[model samples]
Target: MKQSRLMSLVESVANVIVGYGVAVVTQILIFPVFGLHTTLAQNLKMGAIFTIVSIARSFALRRVFEAIRMRSAK
Candidate 1:
């Protein structure tokens, strides 16, 4: 079955929300290993920025793949 645009967006957002948390936590753990230190607020801000970009990329890719699936189905 084909996925609706709204569902695609919802899925992307949900995925990114989980990823945002993971990214922040990972930064907290991993940054020190590389000698990169940042405050909690800074990490959160960076995570938010990356989350927005990730959401956009995920949604766009989903749409592109859906389009391809639709074309191939015809």
Candidate 2:
């Protein structure tokens, strides 16, 4: 049970980080279509800020759901 919980936590974190990477990559690739040009550094900096926000939001929501699940399990 403990191992499963830990494994899930690790997976959740990994998934969030990977999702952030994908989002950033997609944003960089598609931005030019809109005539929004930025240097690589600028794009990366923007991506980093949004990624951190996403990770925090994801983790917080995940914990809230887990708490509610555990509560109902009893």
Model 1, 1-74: lDDT tens digits are: 99999999999999999999999999999999999999999999999999999999999999999999999999
TM-score, every prediction: 0.97, 0.76
Best by lDDT: 1
Show pairs that collide, candidate 2: none
- Per-model C-alpha lDDT, please? 0.99, 0.75
RMSD of 1: 0.6
Taking the tens digit of each residue's C-alpha lDDT, what string does model 2 give over 1-74? Answer: 22355655676678877876787788889999999888878887887788777767766777777778888878
lDDT (C-alpha) at residue 26 in model 1: 99
TM-score of 2: 0.76
Range of the 10 consecutive residues with the lowest summed lDDT in candidate 1: 28-37
